[model samples]
Structure formats: structure tokens, C-alpha cells
Target: MNGRSRARALGVLPGPLPTGPLNAITDVAGVLVGHTTIDDGADLHTGVTAIVPATVRALPAAVHTGNGYGKLVGSTQVDELGVLESPIVLTGTLSVFRAADAVLTYLMGLHPGELSFNPLVGETNDGFLSDIRRRPITERHVLDALEGAHGGLPAEGCVGAGTGTTALGYKAGIGTSSRRLDAGGGPVTVGALVQANFGGTLTVRGVPMPVEELVPGAGRVEPPGNSCVIVVATDAPLDARQLGRLARRAIFAMGRVGASYSHGSGDYAIAFSTADPAPALPDAVLSPVFAAVMDAVEEALLNSLFMATTTTGVEGHTSHAVPYDRL
Candidate 1:
């Protein structure tokens, strides 16, 4: 049976796959998610910052996977150091600059009586539902999301970066899932969290679940494209190339759900592990370690698809929930 068909027939949501303790991105331990949504004005279904912290500590090591096709600030430095020392930020497309600035300001306020800051911010296009031109993300909003960040089942649907998002011929938003892997000896956790703003016909395990069949009024603009921003976290030991390989496999899972990766889509993935850090001093060679990245990435993509909920955005545009009953 197709994925959706199977889900509908059994009356199940796909995210119930065998998981770790929390069945969420937080299962990885030390990871956290936070949101800030704005719907004050008509047709303005957008707002400010959502921070995804790499670790519970204020600063931790990080790395970026897919840096092209979208505006991601501070990725270059992350690549060089292989450590993310800032909170990950997300906002509407045009609000990236403002969001980045706000993150910087928020960082300065993080410590007591200290003021020095540099933050990482990523974005997706929400122009259709949000007033992208207004750049509504503010410093206070960024701080709130960061301050509120916690480790637990992250609030999904019309919240955070996914507040104005859609996916797979349905009203999609922020979704998360995790998997536990037996790498050689002990168990390692791998998790995925996504801001699903992409557009496409729904095809679950090969079933034809297009926009026309489900969300009728939710047609895309000319060129017919959508984008997805995925953040993968793991405790596995992997280098940059391995992380990139893991990110690439995420696209394959997207295809399994029937994503076309249309021209206008910003299909991107960023993956990092808090495992052993590479050597810093000269002449210190690091041994290659590759174990659970691929498996984790595959499961993570499915989680993003399965955990998402339906949504409504700008000008009365609404996307339906995945027809669990139809599956």
C-alpha cells in the first residue's frame, strides 16, 4: 500500500514509528525548539524568530549542511570551526536580515552585564501568506523564542517557523521525529525537525494525493514550486562530508513521499552531530567515523512528513490536514 493509503487504512499518523523516549527532536538530548507566531493583521500570517539550539548550553559546537539556495547567516564560520556557538534562527524570507540583526541583539542580552554577539539565522519564503515586505521579526521576539526554548515535544502546526508553511498537498507546518540507533556498541539518538514551507502534490508511497485532490484553493504561483528547510541533529560521530552525505539522503526520502524538487523549490538540509569533535592543534589527525547518519536522515524526513498538521494562510488560503481517514 502507498504510505498515505496505509496511514489512512489503519487510521494512523505516520509519526508513530518506533522512536526514542520522547519521539521528538528533543530525544537527541540537549536539543530544544521554540516559536513565535504573528496573526495580528489580515493576510499577514507570519511573525518572528524560532530558535533551535544545538545544545542546552548557551553556546555549543555546530555545522551547516545545505547553505545554498537560501539565505543562511554564519554558516561559513560554522564550516570552518565545525562548531555552532549560537542559536539557530528562522523567519520569513524578506525578514532574514532583520531576524539576523535581532538575533545579534538578543545574543548581547543573553549574558549578565556582558554585550557581545554573533548569531546564526536561516529562512524560508512565506511571501504568499505573510507580509514579507514589512520584516516583522523583532529583537524581543527573537529573545522570547530563545528564552523559551526547551527540550520536550516541540509545539507543531501553525507555530514557530512553520506558522505560515504548507507541505505535500496539505496544510503543513513544523514537524519532528527521532530514531535510536545501535552503532557498534551503545545507543545513539538522531532526530529531525523541519519548517515545511514547500509546495507539491501529495504522493504517499506512490498514491496520488495532489493539491487539486485535497487543498483546492491552495494553488501555487507561476512555476509551481515549494521549499523545505530541514535541521537534523544527532549524537553520532561524523565529519563534514559524512554530514553532507546524510543531508543528501534526506532528499531521497523526500522523493519517497513523491517530492519532485521543482525548479522553484529550495530543497535544503543541514545536519550536525554533537559527538566527538575533530582535533584542533596541528598534526592531530582525526579518524573517520561513519555509522548512523543515513538511517537517521531517512527516518527524520519521514517524521517531518508524518508529524505535520494542516494549516490556513493568507487571503483565506487553507491546506487540509493529511487525510488520515483516507489512508
Candidate 2:
């Protein structure tokens, strides 16, 4: 409910190129991000609902990536035909199925007589700071985050699902960044936001630093191994194949911050473009254009890592803030 500036954090990639107005995923015209943080009871360090709304009613588009290891419900249909018709919800790992169900239920309620609604829900584990086993997220929380979604700069750090996330050796949470691409017609925008639940040695601009170097490790939650979720959004007209490429480029952003994509890391990136509406047919003859998708994906990856601040989470887990002063 309150807003504050994040501490020093590094981008997954370099900067200096043109960025969107807010340098956030929401900058991708019509995209919105919202969150709800639950910090009350001694052990209730978790809450739910972080939503990125669809740009238009029954919008047509294609999904470019696939993850066999994790479940991105509604993505299979999206990849088969390269289109999406729903909002995106990010949450704690165990809440994926529940959130997906809630999203479908909500959509059905909205449409009244709709046959299907493939809700998109993504998850990252937050058991270290939160009681994931309790499944703290609820249908009401999901609706609250969705109803509150709006186009503007998104909040960062210990908020929303990110409340329990960690990154590059510190307690980290939601971070966002964006860039404008040189489209032939005009500049297309691509932006990225992340829920950082991964941990390891912290490095920025090739300068290596121990995660503990920034913050002491006494009487705190030990950083979990790598596990992070990145959401990339753009307004470039691109097909599924191109979007997949963009998703891969996001790893470069992770590399810039000294990530090795460890065994336990659930490093996943989902990239989408709102430039062209998704047609409802599987065989719709839509001309594909992807110049902007490439640039936008790369930029968005950087944004996810850059805009985050250091945080401390459950059991006194503390992470050093990106030391802008040190830089």
C-alpha cells in the first residue's frame, strides 16, 4: 500500500538505449501490473495476487515459448497457434494450480456463458520466507490484484509475490526495466519485470561480490539456490518463434548479474508482444513481423534485474541493497 525507493541493483544487460516512459513492462501500452503484500501474523509472511492484465477484450496473439519442466497453463494452446486471450498472474510456486483455477473461475464469471478461459499463471518457490505449504494466496487476493491492475510504473522490492523472493545474494523482489526498439514504422517498446527468488554470489559490471559481503549472514534465512521468474512484455509485432528467441535472450540479463542458472534455479522467462491482436483461429494467416521483439526482449530482461532493491525476508533473511554508493 505504501511506496518507497529501491536500493542499488544491476541490470541484466547494459543500458543507454531509448527506454519506455516508465521503464517498466506496463510501458508496453495497455499492459498493467499490480501486487498485494501480506505482512501481519508472526508466520503469515505470504499473500497473493500479482496480475498483468490483457490489453484488450478477446485480443488475439501468439505464444512463442514452451516450458516442459514447469506448467504455464494456456501456453500450449498459445504456442500451437501463437496467441493469448488472458491476463498473466504470478505467484508463489505451490499456488500455480490454485491461482489458475481461480483465474478461470473469475473469467467465467465475467463472461457468464463462456466455455473456456485459459488463464496464465506463473510461479516461483518462496518457501524460505513464506509458508508455501499453507498456500497463503486466495481467490479474493487474486481478484484484488487483478481489479487493481493499471498502466503505470510498477512497484518494486518486497511487495506482491516478490515479497519472498531473493536475488544475486540478497533479498530481492519485483524489479522492472524497459527499452524502445527501432522499428521500421516507429519505435516499439519491450519491457521486463521479475520476481527474483534465486540466490548466489552477487556481481555487477563484472565485479564479483559475495552475497554475504553486502549483508551479514548471522541469524537470517539462508538464501535458497537459484529460482526466479521473469515476465517480458512488448508492443512489437512478432510471431511465436521470435518471441521464443526473445525469451532466450533474457538469460543474458541473468548472466550480466553473475547468475549461473544453477540446478535449483527455475530460471524462466515468458515474452509476449501486444502489437498485433491475436486472431481466434489456429490457422489464421497473420503476417509475422519481429524486428522489435528481439530488442524489446533484451531490454526487458535488463529491467527485471535493474529496478530491484535489496530486502530482508522471513526468519530474518537479509540481503544487501544494490550499493549504488559503492558503485
Candidate 3:
């Protein structure tokens, strides 16, 4: 929206499904997204991104882990209970606990008498381009992201949790996309927001990007201990088990964009439904939703890379943006 182009604008369509109006995760009704970018123009370049549903009540949700080399706070509870009672917060690796604590603080303030709370907080390493050791994310940053959550197009690339992240040898940050599926019962929307920080070959629609040719001297040096966290939201009445299936599809979509799923990469996807309590969709009708999730996830990952601008951070380290002309 800020004069920045997305993958679609650059002619990189991932699949056949039609995208929602905004072509973003916010296209899912009542889902709000906010970001707190902590860029000091010097060392700090990390911040937080919050995904808040319409209300702070339990919603059907599930988490799937592709490679578990990083932290994902409050995941087990969601898996066990088959619901999420908190707004999902994402930030840098070292700042995960602080973000989770802040989410707890915010949720507690909303419901004073609630005795227990499970705050979903996830993270990916941003040490390559940011002073991650400083752990600059704070309670205020997390709260700001949550409080400012709004429905519409969300800012992507070098913002929020993805500020200092890199993927496929290029700068990447927050990216989102959505798909409207026409199923047997009715139409349902599936949206995905990705914090892409993993390393791979940089493929777009089955074509390997010429990273070496485009950016000479940029060898295949994958970042150490990288990761990606994807959040999928849908308006379909999907139970936790169904949501888990969607989440797995999201993780699988990563490979479509050339994700290596390396040993040190922690690839995780959290899927939730915003529909009111109703009969879950039949398993037979879930194939379209799965296809939608895959398409959205792949496009979102590319948006994270395409929309990102070259960033210079900690100790003069720079993560180059994907060359649009070459693409």
C-alpha cells in the first residue's frame, strides 16, 4: 500500500485460486494485524508482530512443527486443548519470552478474573542483520503491536518480527496472502502471514532464481540457525485436527518456495479458525482448503522476499533485496 510492490504485482502467481480483496491475512474476517518496528538506524532492527482475532476468547487452533530447532511458546497447550486463548505474538529469538509475558499481561488486563492463560509467542533468529544479543524487544513493543492491531493491508518486508531476517539470500520480513475457495458447502477464505527467515535456493513458480547471476559475489552462504513461522487464519469452521492439517499444508508449502528445511531451521505453522462455533467442515470437503493454504503460503513467502528492501544492520552487515528487474 505504501508504493511497495508484492509478488503478484511482480508477476509471480503461485496457484490458480483467487485471492481475497486485500490479498492479505487480514482478509480473514475479524482478523487484525499490527507491527512494532524497532529500527534505530544503527544496531537494533528487531520488533514484534501481533495477530489478533476478533475477540480474546478460545478459538479452534493447532500448531505443526516442520523442524523444531527454535522456540514456540505456548504451543503445547494449544495442541492439547485444541484452542488458542491469546493473540499470537511473533518476535526475535531471544525476545520470545518477553513477548509471551507481554501477551499474558495484555490478556490478563482484559479478563481480570482469569486464573490461567496461554500466550502464543513464536520467533526466528535475526542475529545476521540485527543486534539480536541486545534483546531489544520489550513489553511496550509487544503491547503496542497488540493494541494497534487493525484490519486491512498490513505493512510487510523489513518490519515487525522479520525486520532483520533473511531468506533465500535476500532480505525478507513480514508477508501475507489469502485465498477464497469455493467448496461444496460454501465459500471459505484462507489467509497466511509468514515471517520468512529460512535459507533456500529462492524458487518462484518452479523456476530457480538466478541469485548468483543477479548478485555477483553473493555465494550460497545460508545463515546459521535460521527459521520461519507461518500463521494461517480461516473463516471456515475447522476443528483443531482440521486446523493441524492446514498447518501441515502450510509447512509443506515452504518447499514450493525452495525452503531447505535445514537441520537448524525451525519451521512452524499455526492455523486457527475465526468462524463462530458450528459444525466443523466434513473431512471430505477439506481438500480445497488444503490447496488454498498451500497457494497462500507460497505466495506469502515470496512476498516476504520481494517486498523487502536492502537493509544494512549490525556491524555494517547488509541483506540485499531481491532484484526485481531480473525477476
Per-model TM-score versus the true fold: 0.79, 0.81, 0.98
C-alpha lDDT score of every prediction, in listed order: 0.60, 0.61, 0.91
Per-model clash counts, in order, read 6, 10, 0
Q: Per-residue lDDT for 235-314 in model 2, tens only?
A: 66665666666666665466656665666676766677776634221222212123333344334333333444544455
- For 157-215, candidate 3 gives per-residue lDDT tens digits of 98999898999888899999999987657999999999999988898899888577778
Ranking by lDDT: 3, 2, 1
In model 2, how many backbone clashes occur? 10
What stretches of model 2 exceed 4 Å from their correct place?
1-13, 49-51, 54-71, 216-225, 277-316
Clashing pairs in 1: 8-327, 9-327, 61-84, 62-83, 62-84, 198-227
Model 3 per-residue lDDT at 309: 85
lDDT of 1 by residue, 1-327 (tens): 113221222433333235667656788767888888776546666655454655523232444333256677777766665556677777777777878887777666565576645577777777665666777777777778877888877766556776666666665556666667655355667777777666555665456666555545656432233577777777766655556655665555566566656656777666666666352212121111122333334344444444555544566555566655444
User: What local lDDT does model 3 show for residue 197?
Assistant: 94
In angstroms, give how far residue 184 of model 2 lies from its true place: 2.2
Q: Rank the candidates by TM-score, best first.
A: 3, 2, 1
